[model samples]
Target: MGLVDTLTKSARRSSTTSSEGATMAAGYSAERAPDGNPDDTEVLDKEEGNLVMALISQLRIGMDLTKITLPTFVLEPRSMLERITDFTAHPELIFGAGKIEDPKQRFLHVTSLILAGWHIKPKGVKKPYNPVLGEFFRCTYHYEDGSEGYYVAEQVSHHPPISAFFYVSPRNRVIITGELKPKSKFLGNSVATILEGEDRVRLLDRPEDGEYTITMPNMFARGILFGKMLLELGDFSSVRCPSTNYSCDIEFKTKGWISGGYNAVSGTVKGPGGTAGEIAGHWDQSMEYKDKGGRKQVLFDAATTKVVQKLCLPEAQQEPNESRRLWAGVTRAIKAADMEAATAEKSKIEEAQREKTRAREASGQRHQLRFFEPVGEKYMPNIGVDRQVSGAPLAKQSPDEMARTVKEWLFGEVSTSPSQSVASGTQATPLPPSASVSHFGSETATMASTASMQSLNSVAAVPVHVTAPGPPVDGPKLSIPPPHAH
Candidate 1:
């Protein structure tokens, strides 16, 4: 059977009664559920099995999976723009990290904070909705200490598929700005999403410490063509703070055919003097950190951690281009297990986007961004920074002033005009000339192969000394074309 046909049949079999489905199709609940379950494995049903075989038949060993269309059953009920929030779910870990009297202790807290975010993911081998061009998502966090954090993200570019985001907790003196450029490829029985871009976090009060840069591990969906399907984070990632002269290289180990376990991670914390400590454990369970003197500490225990949920405005109050409101139709259909309706709703959105692109092309006008603007090779928030200065620095504004500025930047003038309400369509510009050969050349393929062969038991046992700083360890580079259409 064809992939869609098999998927439809499977969905029908698993769907609720007609009456229940009809009621659910009327409207999805406004209450947002948590992103994913704690479990990572799913046994394929008969139809899903057929669909997987059909999908594999159409693929090559190293083909890019971006243009390929997948079934609705494999989608998480959220947009990738919102999925980025998972990294910031546990704010308490780094709420006052900058305030620590010792710089080394502060850097350790920051390392733990980065490790805390990876454990929360969707159940099974599900992918989030590829955010349409110009789609945006915003939410607020109300912390226990009565401080509030604001976050906003926009699908800034579509051709190369870039999503830029900004977050700030003024009272907590924390700020984060980053972009994500995920490219997926089929790797035999497994699929890998090479997580590109960097996440920069700055503590406003600790200007001398500089900003910390973090890279993400690539996600692998293993055993897609055979065996039990499971999600794994494979390869290397790093956390570096230049001012503190400290860095942590993390290895998210993949399972081996005969031996290695899932989710195992091990890394060394290095500083100017020498190795400061070592970190080891399962990412989905508990991770431990041992200092040079052999003092062991719990870095993060997923079993005992409580994730703080983000709060969003009502759908009715959100702008037309907001992620939840924009994808509401498809989300409802998917939740109701109505594959036909889901496909139709999803097509409607995609078709509308195509029409917009055509209209922009005809007029020879580029899609104007609403919140972020391209700054050199990266995008930066139009607000929060003092543009009057040569190198834009955070405006010396009070917490209330910053909040007001953010509110205005997000909502803008409180007008009801259609122009003010909706974001523009995809940019008319093509990819930059450098993008074709930028990084991720032949060397990356070799790196990926080398990473896959690494065993979980190979973590180094001895501390290594470092006399000088080296280049920051970032995610593996990979050249990828634009993908994830619907």
Candidate 2:
């Protein structure tokens, strides 16, 4: 057998083996119970009514897919693959957290929740999966009680969903692998991608309006659009960031492919994007994003896209020249691409609990992010920009000091001159007469500018008071066509 086959066999063996730790980490003992042990019965009681009501209260009109509720403390839905896995690792805890009170009520509630939330769906036209709505539930409850339960809930059969893995360790010590499926009931897609320090990805379709969007679903609020990529976006594409969601313009041709097994049709993206790729024997890849800098580090500073690739190995081809084929058998036996890896089954209750808390409590106070919602340019067609943050204090300086003052705070280029105002009586240089009229309009104007967002026609010494992106010019601006339709 080839290396991939061997690895696959080995991985399968390990999972079935008593020593692989998945079963151990699952942390449940399957002691059989007497037949019809009434003690093991579960139901959805008055207590469960709270869970159902809470779920209904959190009901959003747009999440036409499944809806669920965990405790608190999760800021992003990016780690969903790992979180869902918790089912195997901590069955008891998961069962305990349901708060069903009676075993029969618990079973009914858990089973119904799973049926309502996780039923399988084939990935067909109109794929609507929301990764952000990871309000996951479990149908299979592991309550042995010495008796066998015959009831099985409906299963959610999703068509070829995408998964991405990132061996994310500075020294490769830990691998943060993630898997995602598209939920059609929700407006999401079936794509997944992972990122490291030097990865870039692109989408298959160019936006008709020269704009790309990064979105994050709000668990308690309307899903927010992070940014539109018409302007320079790659400038901020870093692997390690405060958030995992961001979009940017990429320099590349659509319908092209990456020879090193990468997809270049979307483009050679350097920011956070989810496109596609293949992994070792057991997996493949795709790409996407979440909101930026919202407690989830991946969603903050990194680009907002994920890629899904295949996990199976490619067949080896023998060159006509055979002298170099001396170790053909050996090379085929040990290639890294052909090696299969072990997968750990997980239980994701705690994961859900943590996510809910983060969404509810982590906004405004700790992490303030800039979405691309422009107050100045909204009405205009096809203008891409970052969401102008509201109530941001002004640049804190007079017209003469506009450029110098902003540069110092934003870039740390301190003024060499003695005249600098910094909340003190430190006398600043007197404003030149010409500087008074033209200072606010200068390109060097700071966030402190008086430009008012409401009046695009109005110009002042602040960002909110500036004139609009002004009426369309008579001449056409050079722009690229939509990447998707073509």
Put down candidate 1 lDDT per residue, 6-83, tens digits, no spaces.
333333332332333423322332111111233566655666666665676677667888777777778877889888
- Cα misplacement distance, residue 405 of candidate 1 (Å): 1.8
Question: What does the lDDT read for residue 43 in candidate 2?
Answer: 21
Candidate 2 per-residue C-alpha lDDT over 1-486 given as tens digits, one digit per residue, 9 for 90 to 100: 543233223323323333323223223211111111122111222333233334334333345433332212111211233223221221111122122232222222121111111111111111121222212211111111110000000111112222221211111011122223333221111111211112111111111112222211111110010100010001121121112222233211111122222111121222234422111110011222212332110101102111111110011221221111222232333322221110001113334435654775766333221111112312110111112222222222222233232223221222221111112332222221211110111112111222321121121221111010111121111111100100
Candidate 1 positional error at 353, Å: 1.7
- RMSDs, each prediction? 17.7, 28.3
Which candidate ranks first by lDDT, i.e. highest? Answer: 1
Cα RMSD, model 1: 17.7
